[model samples]
Each structure stands twice: as C-alpha cells, then as structure tokens.
Target: MDLPQLGTNLLNRVPPRLLSAAERYLKSVPLLRNRLEKETDSMLAGLEGDLKPYRGQLPTFATLPTQGLSHEQVLGEMSQMKEKEEHRWKDGLVSGAVYHGDSEHIDFLNRVYALNSQSNPLHADLWPSATKFEAEVVAMTAHMLGATEANAGRPPEQHICGALSSGGTESIMLAMKTYRDWARETKGITRPEMVAPSTAHTAFDKAAHYFGIKMVRVPVGPDYRADVKATRKALNRNTIVIIGSAPSFPHGTIDPIEELSELARKRRIGFHTDACLGGFVLPWARKLGYPVPEFDFRLPGVTSMSADTHKFGYAAKGTSVVLYRGTALRSHQYFTATEWPGGIYFSPTFSGSRPGALIAAAWASLVSTGEEGYLDATRRILETADAIKRGIRAIPGLHVLGEPLFVIAFGSDIVDIYKVMERMSARGWSLNGLHKPAAVHICVTQRHTQPGVAERFLEDLRAAVEHVRANPGEKGTMAPVYGMAGTVPFRGILSDLLKKYMDLLYKV
Candidate 1:
C-alpha cells in the first residue's frame, strides 16, 4: 500500500468498537505484533534521554550499588536538582508545588525527618515512636477537620479515627476500598457503586476500576458545584458511597457536602468528602471570615474524609490523613493474613513497609504549627489568593471559574487558554492545564504569598493573554494536545497517546 493509504487503513482499523477485536486479531499475527512493538520501542527510545537526566553526571542505580556512594555526593546531586527546581516555587513564580517554602520551616521538618529516618511503623515493636507519631498525626488532622465537634460526647470507638497514607491519592483510594468492604459485609452489596461529582478527583475513578466498584460521575452545575439532583439520581441499589470535594481540583469550587451527605445518610450509604487540597486551609480561612462551605465530619452524614498534610498542611510530600467517623469503618481498610508462612502478615494500608520519617515530619509540623500558626498562614494565603482572583477577573477576555478561596481556575473565551498556558509555562510558571471544558488553573500556595508574587503572576498572565490574542494561531506543545482532544471525533487516539505517555513516565 502507498503511505497515505496505509495511514488511512491503520486509522480506520483503530475504532473503539473494533478495538478489542483488532487487538485479538493483531496479536494472533506475530509479525504485526512484532512490528508494532518495534515501532513503539523506537519512539520511546527518543524519550529515554529526557527521562534519565542524571545518566552520566551522577550514578544511576536501579538496585543497591556494590559500593555505596558517598553521602556528600548524594546530597550534592540532590542539592543541584533542588537548586534547579526551587527558583520558580521559591521565588513565588509557580503554583501549588511547594506550599510552605519558608526555609526555617523546611529545615525543621527535615530535622524531624532525619530524627526518625530509621524508624518504620511496620516494625512497631522496634520503633514505637513511629506508631505514636502517626497516631497523633491522625488525631491532630481529625480534630482540625471537625472530629472534636462531631464526637463531643461519643464513645472512643465512635470518635474519629484514621491512618496516614503516602499521599492524597492513597488516602482517597483507601477510603473507597473501605467503603466497598463495608457495604459488601454489612449491606450484602456484592457489586458496589459510588456516586461522585464529575469534579471529584480522578482518584475515585482509579479506585472504582481497581476495586471492582462502579463510579457514577454526576456532572457539575453552571457554578461548577456538584448537581445535587443528578447525584441523587445516580445513586441506586448497591450504592456504597457518595463523594464530594471541599474545593474540587478542576474549578476549585466546593461541592454542597451538607446536602449530598444528608442524601447519603437518608439512604444509609457512606459519604466521603475529599478535602486534600483545602482541608488544612479552609478551616482557618473560615475562621478568618472567608465564605467557606460545610464539608467535614461536622456535617451529620459525612462518614469519612481525606486531607493531605503535604499540600497546605506544610508537612513533607509523602503524608496525608484519611479519617473515618469510627474505628469500625476504618477496620475495613486493614489487611490480616494469619495463616501465612510469614506469621500474621498484616498492614493498615496497601504497602507492607511504611516511611516513618514522613509520619514524624507530619506530626512535628502539626504540633509546631498550631492553630495560631495555621491561622496566620491562612491569612497570608487567602489574602494573596484574593488579590490573584481580583487581578485575573480584571483582565479582559479571561474569566475565573467559581467562587473559590485559594485554588483559582481561569480561562478565556476569546483566546485559546491552552496557548495562554503554554506562554505562562515558557515564562517559567508551571500551572495545571484542565480539559473536558478546557480551562487552566493556578493552585495558590504559600509560594504565592511572597512579596509581589501575585502581582508578577497577574502581569505574566496578562502578557500571555495578549500574546495569544495577537497570535491566534500559535501552536504550542500542550495547546495542540488539548485542542485535538477537544475538537477530535475519535478518543481512541487520545487514549493511546495517554497510555504511551504513561509508558514514557515509567520507562526508566
């Protein structure tokens, strides 16, 4: 076949309906499979250089080196990478990566981490401090999210309890798995389903796929909040849980957890509130008189919630807390295999071994940054966010989505937002690009709280918008990606590209 005809033939064979059959038929042909694999390997070869940037400059060890590298060499390389990555976040030129960038606070957390580096919670007998620190971290996070108010006169078992997970995704996945098990055991639900806002984190969908649960994603209303009626309609028999976010990742709009959780309560199903991005900041912002919604255990029907200590909580990057209304609900998340040759192999989370240093850093951060500290930090962050929101709103042709507090998403109808995003990225601002409705978001953090950071952001954003307006046909890297996805008829190509991207990420 000619090149054009061959391309058309391959494209025509890749339809969604024909995908499974194509895969089967193609796999049955060894030559076709070999050709495809070879092409993929060659394409991926071009990406391996970018993936392993430290190839010759530093030693790359997939396994333990026979001779340990000097500690100085390891620290030197880490310092070099930190220096390269820190300028944007440290100088307040980026979004959401480094929450609290004050050197003193980071040093303190690092000190705490160093103190507990050798401790492992899995070996509680050897390092009781790890368990104690983790327990306290959970307690502190729980109380911050309204556990104390919810369990004022309740029994110890009824009080809020939780486990510290690796990050927000783990916390959310653990909660979903818990609900799945709870529904199966208690309500005789074999095929469980969860009702979640379309704006809910993708982690819920990940959990549903991994745990054999059906995820019914209900769309958000015009204001970007979850549609309560749609959520109610989505729930049916075998519904295990309903999920809402304090402030969703896409539009930064808080869902009406009070109403949604109440609906779940009426149905006697579990309700989970994902507050990973906002849990630590919203309480203080509300106390500071910012308009915040009720999205915690303080609500009568919210059975569980997940909050990241890494984001706004100012701890290290590996820790988040998942709280349940009671110990019974959390027990569903544990694993125990008493008959194993390993002799009672058990773990509270997915991983067998846990990082104790992260737990210690989390605990230390909580204690060091008390209510007073959080209140002050929230004041700075909210004030900065307010300035940013106002600045973005003032710019012509651009609009901020929802009445958000900290995390702000804005887009333009008159210009391509992805092109604008590409401009911001070129100017050394790493912001998040959102699709489905095609918007870009800048998640405000402590980095943006620095002097003139918000002003610089506004200035850069205005310039970016102007550039995109002038050059309407500017095709940048992600601009074409988002544009193609939005305007294309076939999503199978996007799926394949995403799979390839994932493979690239894990190539090394």
Candidate 2:
C-alpha cells in the first residue's frame, strides 16, 4: 500500500489520541532524535557557506579585544564587507532589503543620525529634542493614515495616539500586549485570544507565543485576502482582538478590513490593522487613484495600527509606529513601576534605552521626504510593480497571485516554481519563496524604479522560466530545500530545523 493509504489504514485502526501519543513517543526516541538532528545538520551545512561567508576571512570576535582596534582598520574591514554586499541591492538585483538606496538620501539620514547619536528618549529632560521628534513622527504617521478624519471631533485623549517601536515586529507585539492587558483588566478574561487571517505577518504568532495569548488564524479567501466570514466565526467571548493586514506580507493582498473591523467593533473588541508594508505606500497610492480600501483610523472599527517607518517611509531601519484609537487604550502598552527604589520608572514601548539616532533619522526622512517625495516614490514603485506583475502573467507557465500594489507574488502551474526561483537567484535576483501554495515574490522598491531595472528583472524572470523548463531533471541548490520545506508533513521537523539554523547564527 502507498504511504497515504497506510496512514489512513493505521488511523482507522488507532484512535487519534493514541496515534498522536505514539507519534510523540517515536519522535522522542533516541534513534529518531539522532536521525532528525543528522537531517537538520545536512540542511544547515548546505546553508553555512552563504550565511557565514566571512567566518574565516574576517575577524571572529567572540569576545572583545584587550586593546581597541584603530577606527581606520575597523572601518576598512567594514567598508570591504559593505562593498561586497551593496552591489546586489544597490543595483536593484534584489528585493525589499534596501528600500531607498539613493546616495543623497542615505547620506542625509546618516548625518541626522550622527547629530543625535547621544540623545535618548528615556531621558526626556536631557534630550527634549528626541521627545519632540518622536511625538511629531507619531502625529505625522497617524495623520497620514486618517487620524485627521478619525479625530476631527475628538479631544486629545480620544485622538489617535501611538509610540515609536523598534520595528514592525515590536509594533505588532506591543499592540498584542496592549490588548492582552486591556482584556484582562477590563473584561476579566484570563484566557485571551486573538483572531487573525492566516496571511497576517508571523509577528502576530510571535506575539501570541510571547504574551500567552491564543492566536486563532482564519483562512484567507480565494483571492488570498482575509476571509471576513471565517474571521468573524473565529471570534468568541475570550477574543481580545482581531487583526487584518493592509497588504499582507506573503501575497500583498489587503484584507477586507472594513468588514473584519466592523465585527470587532460590534463586539467591543480591539481591531488592529497591520500596515507595516502598505502604510507608507497606500495613502499615496490612493491619492494617485489606486483602488485602495479604507484600512486605517478612518474606519470606526480600527482601534489600532502598526506601520514601519523604515520600509517605504525611507527611514533608518529601526523605527516603527504603533497607534491606538485613544490614549486610554495605548496606556495599556506602557510599563510603569512608581514604587521602585531606583526611581519612578516608566517606558512607552518595550525598550528602555533606544537608538534615538534612528528616531531622528526617521524624523528627517519624513520631514525631508514630504508628501511630494513620497507621492513620486509611490508612483514609481507602483508602476514598476505593475510592469513586473504583467510580465509574470505573460510568462507561459507563471501566474501572478493576487491584486497587489508593490509586492507581487507569482506561481507556476507547469514548472517547478522553486527551481525557477533558483534560476532567478542564479541570474542575480533575490526573491522571497513562499509556501502553502508554492510561489515567489519580489517586493518592488525605489531601487527597481531606476532606469532599466524593471526591464532587466522581467527579462531575467522570463529567461529563468525558460531555463527551469528546459532543465527539468537538473537539481538546484535551494529548490530541493524549498520543496522539502513545503511538502514535509511533519511540521515539528521543520521547526526543529529552523531552531538549529538559528543556533548556527550564534556560532563564532
């Protein structure tokens, strides 16, 4: 009998509980554990060269040197590494990593960072400038995402309020933490849960794991957006919040936020729109006449949002904004201990001492790149994305996954899509490989907006398709890895592999 038939037969012979316990026992067995570790080691060994290219060539400082290295020597080594790495993203050969790589913009942000290097928001009295910059950054981001409309008749307390977090993950985790605390304190709910579409960013899962909140992931619709009905059904008395992404990370399709948030509103539960990817682009896109939906504070049901200033906002990498409908809700995100003998202590977000230079850089990026700058950048990015999407669809076996603005995901019906992705990588293109439905995505940025970059991408992509189609039997580096990751039925094995891979990163 086939493996599937044998599994079915075994399942029929044994109760699910017993089968699960037996599987756990088998996984825990010394021999099985050793085999799993061997498999994980093999996979990671293949990735080690790429992950640790400078391991032997450069200094591996597991501990600091007794004497400080000269600034010139340290900078020389750093410059060499930067020179090696910058070409790919600098020339638009990659995706998403370096959003705005223009020399002038980078230099300007660097100068801003240098000027504010010593400043820390934790010492507000010492560095009042950091406080002003953070407040203005939040206000500007909130206004851009419909705070003006949402707070037209409301007081300062009722107006949209937020804190600057380290990045999208921090922003999202902060919001989830806020909801957990709010629900526990107000609703007296001990077992809190959050409902979100499966397509939502994995940060929500991280938050769920970290904060002891149960995450109920509803499946996306046929179009790959969040399924409103399924999400509504996932909610219960213990549900503290519902999350929807404005252009989710995988497929770049915006969820039906209006409907999902409305459900949360009627229930008096929190609704968080994760706009980390789309927050900076969508508002400008809407102004330029894209079919942008209402996913921000303009919607009465949206109680909170998380937007990354680093990505499309064209700032230094560390800043993100997490906004709440009102100060009352945001207060739950704060950490305070007035009774501490050290002193009265309080922090707005997770971090106590933050890189205020990055906050200053975020401020500079926003102020310098005003509405006109963002509008122009958004226009170029969207145009490039449209061309790329059309090009992918034009390929014989490939199809673009959903309606997307800047991030375009495409899959194949007749080709080994991962092999195609591997071919693209061979041709100097770095793309995101997605599972669930085997696909690859390229997030369009200003780098791709440069002259000939989009054309080169499309041409290389077409050539990659043809290459994969011609070389059907040829094994490729990442293709087998992606194939195994996608098709493996034992998810625990994959999780263990990932954990081991993370362990590899810490090795000197």
lDDT tens digits by residue: candidate 2, 1-508: 6996476456557765776676688688999988878877987899899989998788878899999999998999999899989999999998798899999999999999999999999999999999999999999999999999999988989999999999999999999999999999999999999999989999999999999999999999889999888887888899999999999999999999999999999999999999999999999999999999999999999999999999999999989999999999999999999999999999999999988899999999999999999999999999999988888888899998889888899999899999999998988889999987899999999999999999999899889889888889978878888887776555566687788889999877
Candidate 2 — what's its lDDT? 0.92
How many steric overlaps does candidate 2 have?
0
Clash list (residue pairs), candidate 1: none
Worst 10 residues of 2 by lDDT: 7-16
Best by TM-score: 2
Expressed as tens digits, the lDDT of each residue in 1-508 for candidate 1 is 6985476457656765776665567656989767866765665566578566767876566789898889998899899877866787888877788899899999999999899999899999999999999999998888889988999999999999999999999999999999999998999999999999889999999999999999998999999999999998888998999999999998888999999999999999999999999999999988999889899989989999999999989999989999999999999999999898878889999988999999999989989999999999999988998999999999999999888888899988899999999999899888988876788998888888888889999999999999999998767666776776664434554566668868777654
Alpha-carbon lDDT, every model: 0.89, 0.92
**What's the CA RMSD for each of the models?**
4.5, 2.3
Steric clash pairs (candidate 2): none
Instruction: Give the distance in Å from residue 455's predicted Cα in candidate 1 to where it truly belongs.
Output: 0.7
lDDT of 1 at 245: 95
